[model samples]
Each structure stands twice: as C-alpha cells, then as structure tokens.
Target: MDTLFDLDEAPATDPFDPSVSRPYDLLRHDDGADYAATVTGGGSAVVCGDAERVLAAMPAGCVRAVVTSPPYWGHRDYADPAQIGHEETVFDYIERLADLFEGVRRVLADDGSLWLNIGDSYTSGGRRTRMADRNNAARTIDFRPDTPEGMKPKDLIGVPWMLAFALRERGWYLRTEVVWNKPNGQPESVRDRPTRSHEYLFLLTKSEKYFYDVDAITGPNGRRNRSIWDINTVPLAESHDAAFPPELVYTCLSHSSERGDLVLDPFLGSGTTAMVAGSMARRFFGIELNPEYVSIITRRLAGRAAA
Candidate 1:
C-alpha cells in the first residue's frame, strides 16, 4: 500500500524561521511538574497554540495521526478578538482552517491520517447563507443577504464540502465522511425541519495511503459490537464552555494511531485530548489562547495525576 511515510519530494516550504516565535512547550510525564507531566507509556503529546506555530516545534513525520475538531465558523467565542474563526465571515473561517490543514499536512507523518470533526452554521433571524458568499466573508462581508432570512446565514451544510474541495486543490486526499451520530444529543424543538443531532467527521489522509491501527484504540466492548457509541452523560468536574467526550477522542485515537505517536489539538478547549491521552498512555499537546482555559486544563490534568 502507498503510505504517507514516503516523502521523496523536495521540501516545498521551510517552517523553521527565527522570526516565528515557538509556542509554549509544557512537557509533562507521569511523574513531573504535574502540569508538565507527560502521559505514561507510549502515546502522543497535545501541544497548545496556533496549529502553524505548534507544527513548527514538532519534527516532520513525527505524528502518526491527528484527531481534532477545530472551532466551527461563527460557532463560538474562542475568547480571542483577533482569531480567524471567531466573529469572522464564513469564507474567512474556511480559508484560515484550510491554511491550518496545510500546516498539519506538512508535519504529519507520510503514513499519517487526520480525523477532523466539524459542523455547519446557520444565520439567526431566518436568513439564507450562500456558500459562495460565505467564502467572501472570510475575505470581506461587504454583500448583504437578500431577505431577512437571507440576511443571516443558516443551515450551513456545504462548508465542509467546500473545505474538502479546497484541501483537494492543495493535493490532500479526500477520504470518506463519517457521521458522528449523537444518539442522546440534546433535542431541538424546531417548528421546521428535523432536529440536528449528528455532526460530520471527515477522515482525510495526508497521502492517498496512510497508517491506521483500528484495533489499538478500540473501546472496552471492542468494534465487533456496533458502530453507535454511547455519549458520556456524566457532568464535568469543572465548567468547560465547549468540550467533547473522552469516549469520542478515545475511539478516534484507538483506530487511527498507535502507542507513542504524537497527538495534537490546536484548539485545546478544556484539555479533553490531554486528559484522554494521559489515561490511554498517549502523549498530548494542546493550545488554548485564553489563560483561564490553560489554567483550567492544567488543574484538570493535575487532578488526574492526583487521582
């Protein structure tokens, strides 16, 4: 099988530059600065910061797989006024996300795979958001929607398709789109259309061929049982604005990566990736711009160590 590990082409770009500042690298082992403590056994590290900057710190072909969910366009506040996704036009969000993926492709092991989870956006107040116009928003939102429903973008479905197309344009292989069925998802009592429960998880490979160890990250019950996995209904110890379940992370990791491979989350909200990585014996590196979140994740990881 053709693998992502084989890179005979000349380097297209140089990420190492003195001008670019290296993001914070808090290396944590099972027995060190609880905050800097790395996960025991062989796993991956979750580095924190802009994906580009974080990728710069890592050696090329160091990561076996990347499983992450970046901030959706106009979805939530990243607490950074200048960040790309927050408060930006959909077009800008897609472009910026694509830029990050470009960097991800660079550092990713030739045989590595990227599992990205992203959802669409809808404009409030009944407006139709066009995919083409949304693209321009990232550039500039000068054009206004036609009707009130059109004024704001809603039911943002094709954004991922646009992203896939963009990545394909850059030579990244477009793989299958896996649906994350939220069996117990919060109900939405909408007057029109069905409630949105599931989201799309795009499994994109760096090259046409990549490494995938399906059995490594299998759950306690294993993959033979069923495709639908249960969502953790337990309340978090602390309040995290946006957090995904460890089960989801675990499933992705177990299937896509192996022991000792690096796992990165550029948008490390509340450090779920770090926590799961530690438990599963995988190294983790997470980046959060907000100092408060950084502290929350640090304390959470520390608490895990104490437990």
Candidate 2:
C-alpha cells in the first residue's frame, strides 16, 4: 500500500488552516479504479460532488456497511442550492432523501446494513428569515421552508421517522431506532418545550438477515446494546458546521462491520466517518459536495496516515 505521504514525517500542512490550498487531493474511487485502497493501513477516498451524482458511478452492491448522517430538514444551509434539507416543504425534503437512498440501497450488499443518524425540525411558523445565532453562527439562513400541510406553527416535524418510514416503503428493513443522547447538546432558546437533547439513529438493512455482530457492541453491563446511546456531541473547529461525533460513527462501525470491510458515508462532512473507519482498519469512501470540505477530508485522513 502507498503511504498517503510518509507517515513517519510531520504533516506538511494543517487541515484547519483555510489558506492552505492543497490539503491533499483525494482521488475519486469508481469501479476498480480505487486509489483509496492504496493507503498504508486502510484505504479511504473522498468524492467531491453531489451525493446522487457520485453514487451513480460506484459499482453495485459494493459496500458492506453504511454509516451516515444526511442533512436535516430546514436546518443550517450549506450555501449550496443543490444541497438537501432546505426544500420548500417538509415532505419534499423527505422525498428527496428517500429518492437518494434508493441509490444507496442499490449499492449496498444484500446482507449489508445502514446506520442513519438524523435530527428532527420544527415548523417555521411562517417565518422567512433566520438571524444568525451567537451559539451557531452558521444557523443564519436567507430562506425558511414553509410549514408542511396540516401542521400548525412550531410543530415538531418528526422528520427522522418520516424519512425512516419512507425508506422502509422503498424496501429497506427498518430494524431499530437508537436514540443518540447528546449530554453536551447546544442550548435551545425555546422555553415552551424541554431543551431538545437527542437525535435518531435508525438501523436499516437491505435483507431480512443482515451482517450485524451483536457481540461486538455489548453494553457496559455485559448485556445487549440498548436503544439509548449516551455519547457527547463533539464540536469541530472547521468550516463544516455539522460534524457528528466520532464516537457515534465508531459505535455504528463496531456493530455493523468488520475490519477490511468497505464502509460508505454519503454525507461526508468533515470526514469523521473516514477517519474513524481508517483507524479501525476498515476501507472507506464518502461523497461530499463542497470542495472546501473535501480538502478537510483529505487533510484529516493524511493526518491519520502521519500518526
């Protein structure tokens, strides 16, 4: 395997520095032309493009496990019109995600599984503008999606379950829903309801009997893993706003995949999935639309190689 760049030496550049142009140009992997497989310990590739477009070029049934957190509906805009999560209506957002996962199901191995992490959203209450929040400056938005039909203002949209059932309708087996409890979740300004502190992680499979190792993810009490995960949310000091905690990815990887398995993450924000996959000796590749975010992925993976 080719070293990403001599692991023995210090990394030539810092990934967090925006001025650095070439964090490392990660080659796009398609069919048998997978340069990511050449990394010394484990392979990783970052495809910089829209998720649907990039997934089209990959081989069928090639992925052993998928661990991803697609963009949440009506959340912080990634500044791309083509990006998901900002549909005119909530149902439209679900349709778009369901349609994209159809391609994901096609590329998944028959016995493979998908661990999806998604958060819910509230109705816009007819508000068209969103001011920047001091806690999360990226929450600023130029446009706000209208509340869905038959829903009142400030209603909990339940987007996670909506998308989960949508995928189940598309032939995915919805096996489980894991509550990801964020003990250090960002404070919400709403006083009417309890401060939201959790998101949903749904485990879906392509077939009835899939490749999940129950023994691998035994709870601390030496029993089966429970539905609620008490993992803290990790903050990234980078341009990408929503980088899910690596512990979440690590737990998903542990339960669903083995070493050398090909793991896929369609929404590779900040490359957390790829970094954790490589550390565990699993081959990984991901799709991201932002070019700047793609640089973050390569720089991160390169840092892992150097370590």
Candidate 3:
C-alpha cells in the first residue's frame, strides 16, 4: 500500500514571515510531488491542497473515522477559492459540503463513521454578516452571500441542521448530535437571548452497525452515554481560528476507532487531529488548502517528535 508521508520534502514555510511574497505559497512541493509522497511516509501525512482533490488520491475504506471541523458558513475567509463554507448562500454552502463528503463517504470503511463539528452563523437582515478576511491578518468586512429562507436579522441560520439534513438526504445515516458546551464561552452583546455556549458535533455512520467501542470512552464510574458534552474551545496562536480541544478529538476517537486505525481529517486546520491521533497511536491523513497552515502542521509535528 502506498502512503503519503514525506516530511523532509516539505518547504518548511514560516507563518510569521512577513517577507514571504504572494498567496498560497508553500515552502514544500508545489507540483504535488510531496502530496504524492504523502502516502509513503509513516505517522501523519499532511497534504496542502484542495480537500476534494486530495481525498481522491486516498484508497477507499482506508479511513476508519472522519473527524474535523470545516469552515463556518460565511464566518471567515481563508483567502482560498477552493475552500468551502464561503459560498454565496447558506443553501449553496450546505450543498457544497455535502458534495465534498461524497468522496469522504467513499473512502470511509463500510463500518466507519464520520464525526463533523460545524458551527453556526447569524444573519443580519436575511444575509450573513461580514467578518475578517484573514488575508491581511486583520478583521474586516467580508463578501456578503445570499440569504437562506426563514432567516431574519440577528437570527441563527441553523447551519448544522441544514448540513445534517443535506447529508442525510445524500444517503448518509444521520446519527446523534453531540452538543459541545463551552464552559468559557465568549461574551455576546445580545440582550434578547442567552449567550451562545455550544456547537453541534454530528456522529454519522455509513452502515447501521459500525466500529464503535462503547467501553473505550467510559467515565470513572461507568459508561456515560449522555449526548451533551462539556468540552472547551481551544485557541491557537497559529493560523487556525476555530480549533476544538484535543480532549474533544480524544473522546471521538476513543468511541469510534481503535489503536493504529487510520483516521482522516478533510479539514486539517492546525493539524490538531493529526497531533492528537499521533499521541493516541492512530494514523492520520490530513487535508488542508492553506499552505501556511500546512506549514504549521509540519512545525507542530516536528515539535511533537522532539518532545
């Protein structure tokens, strides 16, 4: 079996380097050579390219579980056209995600599972509010996408369910939604409702029965099967904006996969999934479109190996 793990071929791009000229510039292989070599290297293989294209190279049924938080709908743009979630409308966004996951479903084992962590966005006057562009590394107004039905100003678009139902319609068995309650939620200025403190993590399986180890993630007392999860949101100094805690990944991997099982993260932001997968003795294949983030993943893996 061919693997894609060529760390030495990576360009070692620095995120903080202001002298770097141009966008999507990676210090690694630009002709997709390292990406082709990704399957060869053992441990975590991080590919910096379009997720849809990268996932196509993966062998079917090679992944045990697919876990990663994709880009939020119109929240922030990573300055990449190939990146999802920056669509012109909420409907378009969900459709694009569902289409991307078609490859994901194909690569997933028959007994595999997919855990998706998606965030919500509010509509201002039947449209998504503008936020940071991330190209200049500053907060600014972004392009406004078309509004979806039943959304008013200051109303949450329910992006999670939109995506969930969309995926379910595409032949994926819609499973339970795990509420990720943040203990230290950011303060909000809304006076009509309570502060937002949670996001949804959907657990979907391709088949009726999958490789779920119920006893793996048991608490001290016994098996805790509650749906509401109290996991904190993680902040990173690297290029990633929305990163979940490693404990969250640990819980998902513990319940869905075993040691040495292959895991796939289609939206590898800071490479947290690969990092935690390495610590837990699981193989990880990560896909990220941003080159800077690919560099961050490379730097992070090196640090972990040294320690």
lDDT of 1: 0.59
Q: lDDT tens digits, residues 201-302, model 3?
A: 999989988988887755559956578887666667786767667778878888898777777898988887877777776777788888888888788787
Residues 1-307, model 1: lDDT tens digits: 1211111121212122243222233232333322332232223233334556555545566566677777666545456665555533556667888887887887678888887878765554333232332312222222222322224434444667778788788878877777667666655545677877777777788887787665553435674423454443223556554577666776677777765556667677788776665565555556565666777887776565555
lDDT of 2 by residue, 1-307 (tens): 2211222242322222233121123333444543222232325567777788667766778888999999887777787878888788888989999999998998899999999999898888999887777776767777788878999999998899999999999999999999988888887766799988999999999999999888876745788878998888767767887897777887888889987777889998898887777666677878887777888877777666666
Task: State which candidate, 2 or 3, has the greater TM-score.
Answer: 2
Q: Candidate order by lDDT, highest to lowest?
A: 2, 3, 1
Per-prediction TM-score, please? 0.72, 0.86, 0.83
Clashes of each: 40, 0, 11
lDDT of 3 at 114: 96
Which regions of candidate 2 deviate over 4 angstroms?
A: 1-42
Give the top-scoring candidate (lDDT).
2
Better of 1 and 2 by TM-score: 2
Provide C-alpha RMSD values for all models, in order.
Answer: 11.4, 7.7, 9.2
